[model samples]
Target: MTPVPEPLPRRVTVHLVTGGPAGPRLFGARVLFGQDPADVARRLGGLSEEAPLIALDVITEIASTPGRVPTPLHVDRVVFATPEAVDAWPAVLPPHGMEPMLAELVAEEPAPAVDRPRLRRMASYGIVTDPTGRIMLSLIADGFPGAGTWHLPGGGVDPGEDVRSALRREVWEETGQQGVVGRLITVSSHHRVPLTGHEVYAVWVFSHVHVAHPGPARVLEENGSTADCAWFTPDQLGGVRLSATTRRGLEHLVGPA
Candidate 1:
């Protein structure tokens, strides 16, 4: 039997961001040195000769921080890429040894800076019900901006509120009909809007047994978010316009039955 070869240590180049919000920001490339340090340096040095200075900075950062550095000591906006040539790294690197050289290299060259916006988020759901209490489908209003087509009678989950409560509130507000939540159906996501997007998780639910009122459905509030809520049978959906996500939600709620 042949002896199994030891797995070559994987190499990764990581970008480190250092500096305070008010002070100058520095970007450094760090090469994750594996078994050998000297070989790592040689490979990085060769790459730096051909690649841009920014690439060199990233390599230097990785070489400086080996098994011990905590992630937060670095600032935000670090980029990491797996090295394609793992075998080229040196087999022997000194422990706790490369920081001084890395510091000097980073001092000589600094990285460019930019501001990134914080992501804003909100959660909603699709509530559906079927006829004869078997399947459920939520009513969706058409022509809402960015919604494009189909939508469920659900909206933003409030702070500290559970998903069930949010779904009930959204259903009542959109459909003006009370319903009891049944069981969780499915969860889905939609990213039609560029910066602001919606993540919807749906639950199959039955109509509240107590509430009994019905009339011609029309836009009750017209708050610019929705046009009107109208229930549809699975067969009725054929001609009516619906969003792909909403359509998918309907399928989950009522599949073949």
Candidate 2:
């Protein structure tokens, strides 16, 4: 059997049109590796300056074409939201301008791994709610940071995988439950030095999720990062220790629970 090559990282060039007579518009064009917004726009039959560049949403997929794209007349994703409501969208918004980031994204050379061993990871976690209003959490297995502590059911997004898909996969693997992915609630980033001997930066995307009917919580993956899983009521949460990301997500999404 032939070995499969790794899927290249994808770029979503997002332009936020906050002001104009036509009102607000959010335009996103999905571009492949080494493709810029101008190239994508030209291929789509539109102008690259349709709106102001605001964010670059990166996604990895298992497989994709070289440069297949959305039509110019109809973009891949479009939305209209007030500035305050932008966070509700599924796209990740950066804190600063996207120009510098965009430049680095299309760089030809990969960052060296031998120096200090730096890694950046993206993950999707959910604040899952059952019909009974209970929240689900999973215990981190031993040898991991915050072992014995509980956190939301999620892990790192795999290479070539989108965040939403990763969330569902991880949720099922860690908790053995099915969830309907809802709106994005928050995005957070944390940098840790010397974490398992690497300087790691993690970007966490949290969303509200609903589990219409749930079975007994259990870890379903063999030797996975999760040791156990369970649901908890808000009142029962005070005594349980939570990972920093989980605590922050819960506080932002549903208040200190």
Candidate 3:
């Protein structure tokens, strides 16, 4: 009788899909083992290219079950697969690494993972009133919320930066006016669907301001999105297009504009 050749050592790996936050994904895959170690590696590598964000490593299919590893006939060296190398033929093998996803996989009292919404906070627009009681509004040339429309002269407040300082810098940059930042008039927020289709919540702080008779309003930010800056009374705003954000801001700052 002729001797039979033993099959090369290779195992099927499955991400083991389960209910709950189980791993990064349902973590299941169909793997084929070839007689050649290199061919087996090639098949595993091919499976990895589709998911760019995840990390896949090769391991002996000993206990290839949901978040479980069984005893292995043999283990391969270099199991961790890199995304870029996955496309190459017979790519380098990486060492086996832990699947932290397993820890995330909850078998009891399962709760599905949820992605929470994000938030952006900024504000410091000043209601710099003249004797006429009109506030300083700057016309935006481009960018979000409003373009070719007027809004209060201020911008986003940097983290750990004084709100008053940020307001002053914004006022100076957009309208080139120096003023004393006064009491916070109101804090207002508006929610809208941004271009990314994600909900965005913006909160701003509007403050009462006092300033002397200032020089001509100059746009200090060179080639900035602000096309023009000036003081305008509510009556003058009759024809101007007000951004929804500005409308909400105005509703909170003074009265309906």
Candidate 4:
């Protein structure tokens, strides 16, 4: 049996040439290196032989991976084009009329930045009821920005960690309650960019829990992210300051409590 040959890898040359008074402008040419690397290099915007250029290695789209953000520069103007659109290599690139092309490409077809703002979050909370049928909740002392806001007895889900496991740990640490997390109560999320200036793309998950408790909720750890913890009845939930998550938790587990 004959073995199939792998598809040829696309190699590319990028040109960084001075655009008149503007700083450096980038352009690219790509083809299978085995077919015509030198030709592709020559066609990259027909950059002048004297113009300074930066050589880079660009693999085929299949081989491309997520990368770091490119530094933005203050340029007089930038002229750039994708290699795919240039079907036939021209003998000479037009020197004039770059402004219109630059406007169309840069403004209309803005390149997706590698470090664009992306939302990411994950949390787990357990629901525990006291002998009076009151729900266990935690008060944020220092961590959650809202000092006295009520929150579910749970916290963030660490990577490579099970959802139930994270909930169990958070419940113990924040409320001094021991429990086995039960079926999921609800899954909800809200989007907001943190001021910390980090970009992370993620999905959020929530679950309901059954606690094997000896008594009411109390802060297990001293001076933890949670300031204080307690069990509150449904009638009292409305009067107390509550986080959105806490409100949602109440709405899902029991109606409007």
Q: Largest lDDT belongs to which candidate?
A: 2
lDDT of each residue in 90-143, candidate 3, tens digit only: 232223433322222222222325344545344567777665576777888877
Worst lDDT 10-window in candidate 4: 71-80
Tens digits of per-residue lDDT, candidate 2, 1-257, equal 99996444533332332334663334434433233433343334343435332222333323222235521111122122334434644443445532223333343445455567656566789898999999999999998888999999887877656777889999999998999988767554566766357777666667777999898898889987899999999888888998887897899756775
**Given candidate 1, what's the lDDT at residue 219?**
40
Q: Using Cα atoms with residue i matched to residue i, what is each candidate's TM-score against the true structure?
A: 0.41, 0.67, 0.51, 0.50
Rank the candidate models, highest lDDT first.
Answer: 2, 3, 4, 1
- Candidate 3 residues lying further than 4 Å off, grouped into runs, are 1-119, 194-196, 252-254
- On TM-score, the candidate that comes out on top is 2
Writing each residue's lDDT as its tens digit, candidate 1 over 182-212 gives 6444332333223344422221221122223
> What lDDT is reached at residue 202 by model 1?
22
Candidates ranked by TM-score:
2, 3, 4, 1
RMSD of each: 20.5, 9.0, 23.2, 21.0
Which runs in model 4 stand beyond 4 Å of their true positions? 1-119, 194-202
Better by TM-score, candidate 2 or 1: 2
Q: On lDDT, who's better, 1 or 4?
A: 4
lDDT of 2: 0.63
Each model's C-alpha lDDT? 0.39, 0.63, 0.53, 0.51
